[model samples]
Target: MSGVDFEQVMQAALAADAGVAGIVSRRIFPLSAPKGAPLPFITYQRVSGAPEAVLDGDAPCERISIQIDAWAKTYGEAKRLAKAVRGVMAGAEFAAELDEDRDLSDEEARVCRVSMDFIVWA
Candidate 1:
C-alpha cells in the first residue's frame, strides 16, 4: 500500500531476536556485504513481486517477500542462526510467514549458508 511504510517492516525484521543479533553482530545487509567481511553474518534482500491494481484510490494490500540468509563457518552455527531468525519472524507484528529454508555448505570456502524465505502482508 502507498500509505503503508515498509520501514516498519524492516524494523521488525531487525528486532526479531537477540540471538540473531549475537550471531550477526547487528550486521544485517540490505544490499551487499563489505569486501573481506568476516563470516557468520546475515544478509537480506526484497524480492520482486507482481504488480497489484489499485481501485478507487484505495491502496491495495502489500505483499512483501524477503530472503534472509545466514553465513557461518560451521553447519551447526548456521542452523542455530536460522532457527533464531525463524523464531523471531514467526512472531513479527505484521502477518509474516516463513515459506522455506535452504541450507548449503561450501567445503572449498569452508562455510555454511542458510537461506530463509518469508512473505509479509501489510
Candidate 2:
C-alpha cells in the first residue's frame, strides 16, 4: 500500500468506465500512445506527486498531478472523449478534479487532441 501504482489504478478506473470504453475501447496507455496505433485513443503522463503526511507517518495514497490527453482524428471526437474523461473524474469516489484543459494540434500525426490536467489522490 505504501508504493501505490497510481498509473495502474488510474488506467483501471478509466478502462472500466463504460463511457470511456465506448469511445476508446482498451487503447488507454501510459506516458504516450503507440506510434500510429489508432485514432480516438488516450494517453496519460505523470506531472508530479507527493505523499500526504500525517502525524505519525505519510498516507498510503499520494496526491498526483497528471495530464491526460484524448486524441482523435477530429476535434469534435477529441472534445467528446475529453468530456467523458471529465465526467468520470467528477463522479469517481476518489479525490480528483480537472485543473486545466487545452486543445492541441498534432501536425505530425495529423490528429486533434484535448489535453487535461487533473489532480488526484491515488
Candidate 3:
C-alpha cells in the first residue's frame, strides 16, 4: 500500500481505539519496506484467490496486516491508550496487537507496535 494509505489507516485505528487525535507525526520509513529498519514496520499485501468484497485483500474473505508505532505522554498513559484502542478496534471487527516500549528520554513517550488485519464484511 501507499504511505498515505498507511497513515490514514493508522490514524483511523488510533482514533477508533484510543479516542485520540492522531497525526502522522513522523515519516520515518516507507510503507512497504521489508528490512534495514527497526521492528514493527507497517506492511500490507493483497491476498490471492480471495473473494471480491475484500478491500485490500484479493478475496472478499481475506485481510491485510497493518503495523504502526504509537506514542503517548507516559507509559501508563500509553498503556491505557493502547487498551482503549484495542477495545474499540475489536468492535470494528479488527484484531489488534499492541506492543509497548519504554522511551529512554525524559519526554515520557513510549512506542507501541499496533497491528490489525483489515477485512471487509459483506
Best by TM-score: 2
Return model 1's CA RMSD, one decimal.
Answer: 2.7
Q: What's the TM-score of every candidate structure?
A: 0.80, 0.89, 0.39
lDDT of 1 by residue, 1-122 (tens): 35656645664566556778778876677656676778888778888544455766635666778888888999999999889888777776775699988999889989899998988776
Query: Looking at model 3, which ten-residue stretch has the lowest summed lDDT?
Result: 40-49
Clashing residue pairs in candidate 3 (N, C-alpha, C atoms within 3 angstroms): 17-85, 50-59, 51-59, 51-60, 54-60
| Predicted structure 3, TM vs. truth | 0.39
Summarize candidate 2's per-residue lDDT along 29-113 as a digit string, tens digits.
9988778788899999999999899999987768989999999999999999999999887777665899999999989878999
What CA root-mean-square deviation does each model show from the true structure? 2.7, 1.8, 8.7
Name the 10 consecutive residues with the lowest summed lDDT in model 2: 1-10
Q: Compared with the true structure, what per-residue lDDT tens digits does model 3 show for residues 6-107? A: 335544555543244332222223345434543322333322223356467565233334333333344455455445544544465334333332322243
lDDT of 2: 0.89
How would the candidate models be sorted by TM-score, starting from the highest? 2, 1, 3
